[model samples]
Target: MRCGLVLVALLTLPVAAGRADEADDAFAKKLGAIVRDPRQSLWARVEAANMIGKIGPNAGAAAGDLIAVIERLRPTEQEPLQEAIVEALGQLGAPAKAALPAFTRLAGRTIDLDLALKQSRDAILNSSDSQEIDALARQLLSRDPSSRVRATKALSDLGPVARNAAPFLAIALGDADADVRRGAINAINRVTPNAKPTEAFVRAIAVDLRDPDANYRLLAVRALGRLGAPASIAVADIDALRSDPDPDVRRAVVDALNRIPIPQLPPGVTATNP
Candidate 1:
């Protein structure tokens, strides 16, 4: 009787798992049908997209079809659709890498979409596995822009772990996509805030400060400020640029310098208190 019971239990396991998969497939099919059907109200489509965002990176399988839904709508009508798709793609991480162009096209074109797009772009590259995140960071040099962006955004999301991604980010700093380059520089600064000014980690932002693009200069200055006193070593660099050609860049220089503290001496090298 024990053997009979064990056999029945084992047999039922596969059926249970299969039923779960079947239910998932049925749900996805129903969702796709609803999203693609014109008869579905805008609110219904919105709900479908919201469901995808809730699923996060687990929604990679539906990324393509979801993107298709966005493409079918006019750009003027894409804000709400963009919000849902952005959340879904961000959650899907590396799996939705192929749809980056679609995401990029919408970037910076609309005020509402821009903020979500900035935050959403990083979601496409996130992963629970540190190793997977590391590998994705190494793809910054991929000939495919989308693939490179995937790595860039993933590394950015990894924060301090991006210290391991410095080499790749250095490469990304030279990428043609202005967004990727800035993102890489931003990640390097966030991860290496306390790194000595002379460290190679600061090289990426150093390049950005001198970059002709004011946006790049502004980003570099913002990072320097975020570093506070540990980054005080750049005082000469910042002071020299206080009269920068761009008003925003100059303001950042002042703010960054002002934010640096006076008491951040190197470890084991204490300074006398005033």
Candidate 2:
């Protein structure tokens, strides 16, 4: 009886596995049907696109169909469909790489391509894997105008893993476009917590501190603080900044000094006293 029971348990395993696979197939089929149905309203189609993205590469066979839909609907005056297509491409992940060349070619002919590329950047940046992030960053770096913006955004999204892109980011600091330069500086400040601000960057911020651009000065001060205590003593201008006319700049200096882990005072003198 024991032998018979063991034999029966082994026999049922394949059947159970098959049932699970069949269920997944049925679900995929249903989603495909919804996505393909012309009678569906634009909103419904957008919803279907979102569902497909959540399903991931399980819907690989449907990639061609989805690409076609994105191409056709991209030019439509409807915003919802365009949004849906962007979301769907993100869901497609690396599988969508095959479609990129075509997308790039199309991008050359129209302004809408910029929006689509931005959506792709958002999707890739939000992905969970470092490999995907790197791949997307490399692709974006190949484009003009978009390259600098996308790379900056990607570095921000990548957080610590973006250390590998340091060389490229360093070059971006001198970009002709001020926005790109600002973004690169912001990204570097974010990715390199231990980074000592370069002399050029320090001087740049110093100049901006007196500039009319309040936002520029604000970002510079914030970046300086994150450079931590090591940088404070290293920078020649730190003493001067302690007395900056801008209250915010002075506050930032104090905060930066505090970040440096100093030894306890020998006697009565306290951190606040200094």
Candidate 3:
């Protein structure tokens, strides 16, 4: 009786696994249809992408469908969908490799897709932690805005241990995209705020003081304040913003100035504050 029970259990295992695979494939197929349907609402398509990612590699059948959806969209209509698709592709890991070329082409169409693309490729290759960090650092410097945004965010999530990416992040401070610049500052604050601020970094933050966006100016001042003494080079620049048109910016400027230890500069040397 014991031998018979063991035989039965062994026989059921493959059948059960097969059923599970079939079910996963069915679900993936349904979700892929939703993703491919133009009539679907943006949120619906995004939710479908999320579901495919949640299913992981078993939903590999949907990889080609997801790529098709991305390739079909015009740039004007892609912003909301592409990010979600890129994220989903990353989650699919090895099965999504065929989509790599699509990711590359999409990256050229926008600045936000590169980081996600790199992440997807990493997933396909199953990169190690160190490799991921190295890849992200390289992506941080990518001219693709989306790539830089994703890279900064990934580094920020890694916390202070990712301080090595800080130098690359400094370059992002002057990025054309405000979100990328903001992400860089936020990452810097997390990764190396306690370390001595770099001269180039201070100059970059100082430039933000004159940004047309009031909120970005506020964020820049707040980051400088957090750096305290290291950010003294930007003291004069912060002081100039004391009379900014925006009241909130004026208040943050005051707080930042108080935190930053102002230094006296020599007459012959001009402060590179801005």
Of 2 and 3, the candidate ranking higher by lDDT: 3
Whichever of 1 and 3 has more TM-score, that candidate is 3
* Model 2 lDDT tens row, 159-247: 66777676677777766666666667777767785777785565545445555565655556566556565444323344346677677
Best by lDDT: 3
Q: In the order shown, what is each candidate's alpha-carbon RMSD?
A: 13.8, 15.1, 16.1
Task: State TM-scores per candidate.
Answer: 0.41, 0.40, 0.47
lDDT of 3 by residue, 96-180 (tens): 7778778767776556666777777777765334556778999988879899899989989887778777778888888878778
lDDT tens readout by residue for model 1, 135-208: 77667767788777777777767677667777677777777776676677666656665655443435455567
Candidate 2 Cα outliers beyond 4 Å, as residue runs: 1-93, 96-147, 189-207, 241-245, 254-274
**Candidate numbers sorted by lDDT from highest down:** 3, 1, 2
Error of 1 at 236 (Å): 43
The C-alpha lDDT values of all candidates are 0.64, 0.58, 0.77
Which ten residues in a row are the worst by lDDT in model 2?
Answer: 7-16
- Rank ordering of all candidates by TM-score, starting from the highest: 3, 1, 2
| Clash totals, every prediction | 5, 0, 4
Model 1 segments more than 4 A misplaced: 1-26, 128-274
